[model samples]
Target: MAKEKLNYIHIIVTVYVLQLGVDMFRMSNMLAEDFGTNGWIAILIVSIFVVGIIYTIGLVYRLGEGKSIFEILENHLPKFMLYPFYLGVAVLWTLIGTFIGKHYIFVLQMLSFPTTSQSIFNGMLIFLAIILFSMGIYNMVKAATIFFFFTVWTIFVVAFYLPEFEFIRLTTHFFSGGDGYIKGFYRVFVTFFGFELVLLLFPYMQKNTPVFKATLIGHLLLTSAYVIASIVCFGVFSLYQLKYLLVPGLELLSYIELPFVERVESLIFNLFIGEVIVSIGFYFWGAQEMLIRLFRKHSKAKKAKKLTLALIAGIFVYSMQFDTLIQVHEMLHKLSLFHTAVIFGLPIVLLSLLFWEKRKEKKSNAKSI
Candidate 1:
């Protein structure tokens, strides 16, 4: 049931959860460094750009009649060309899943359990993602919807910081404090990276699902979260303070002393574990879909199970190589570059192919007429 049917709500929550990830915690820090005093504006600009990309994703689904990209590309392209692209994305997505999972595990280890081995949490997460992937799109979407609620309430926690928010901290200067756009924009843009997995989601969506609109709503929801988080972060911390803080969002949470919770940040921060799992699960799903289709297997039993195990193994093995947080960030820098190309480039490629096919059909019809 790789093509398990799903509704618009599933896609909506899936997109939002997929896009948010672990980046939300450090967004203000990234923005403060990238766009400076008003670097948060990058969220708006990138939102517009990513929305356009999301539209193309919907159009590609419409044009291709909800076929999987592997199905569409395989029909129009040759095996020699097709398989490698499939394999490339499969590996790319898997690597991304690995890195993202590793990063989250590192942060959790640092926060709550300094002595606990990273491999334990990392391995458990990969195993959970493997199970999610095996459950297929319908279940994954359901799981993400639940995850969406669990983590989303934390966004409103910005309210606690309202008393301390300073308009002066936002400052009068327009984009005055950033160091460089390349690094800054990259960090901010990457926050929205996983939304591109919507391309793989086409097959699971039912006809007349209005996936286009759902994605817009979902993406806008994510943008609102980022903007609000950034605003609170800027207001609560000076530009100088933001530069040094690793996770301004968590810092916001640290100020929130609830009547029930002792470690407010810990409780809220651990909830993000759900969001990260959903994120990694989608990537692994996308990668697994490509691999399964490439082999042309009808029975998913043995093949799919084997693939899941292999991906989990790959994630663990690959993640072990990065011994330091610095190494993880360095690789994320590269992954963000690759993620940019894939999200933007996939839509362009799909559109060109569909247009070319349309032109060829018109030519043949003219001759027939």
Candidate 2:
């Protein structure tokens, strides 16, 4: 049976919501701290590489030939050989989702509710993610699409800061240093990392939809928005100032003085809650889907989803103990190597193997004919 599939807009929303959360919340500051004046350069370089990765993922999606990647791989490869890769993806996204939830809860604690217990927020969020995942892909993507318009106006708020921006602040040396640039690149790479969701999500997209074009267009939009926000932050703050701030984009928002509002950033932060939910929801969904593949072989769908949700929520709550924001950043920095190997390297290797196998299979059929 043909599975229900998402249109291009849903795909775009899925990608958009996936990338917008922790990345948009804190990435500009990380870039500024690492590359200083050359932050934008680091972003541009990484974005080009990420776009190529997305394009390749779209190609791999077609190789699924109407099945999910898990189904395709399971049908063709030995279970022992394929299950580890599936487990790696499941673990990677689960950890990423956990960290994002923890980080945002910590941020909220820092900004608004110092007296509130983070464990409460963490539990609530994981519970919320599980409920959303149970609703299935179409509802999740629909949620992403609706939340986007609620948050879209915040992009234009960057414009309000333009008059205060001193273009000379952007005049620092282009190459801060090769070493520093590389460090900046790695930090920014984490921000750009979520687009690879397309690999896992391919089968869910409508068969007739232009997955490549939709992902590319969606990425272009995401990239442009982040670049503009990063540049705006760079232009508004000196290197010394930018390096110390936790969320420079929020700082940009703090400057706005509306007739009725006292702090525009506070309002913006609340609006961003929807984005955070959608982003984390996608990861939880990805993790749950991978679990179904590993434990259920895609059968017993209802039972698998329930078990996956409980396992994820339990892990998320347990991991939130005594985790400070600095600790979270340091932990993510150390985990980058593992992330690169599993999330980035494994896909490329798998794509090559799939292409080779398909070509050989085609040749074999031609010979038989």
RMSD of 1: 2.0
- How many residue pairs clash in model 1? 2
The digit string of per-residue lDDT tens for model 1 on 1-369 reads 554578898888988999887788889888888778877888898789788888998898878777777666766877888778777887888888888898998888777988988888888988898788778778888999998999888888888777898898888886787888877766777888877888887767788788789899999999999999888888889998888999877777877787898888889879988888888888888887777766575666468557756866866787787878889999988877777787888788888788888899999999999
Model 1 lDDT, full chain set: 0.82
Clashing pairs in 2: none
lDDT of each: 0.82, 0.75
- RMSD list, candidates in order: 2.0, 2.3
The local lDDT score (0 to 100) that residue 134 gets in candidate 1 is 77
Q: Least lDDT summed over 10 consecutive residues: which range in candidate 1?
A: 293-302
Q: How close is candidate 2 to the true structure, as a TM-score?
A: 0.92
- Per-residue lDDT for 2 in model 2? 65
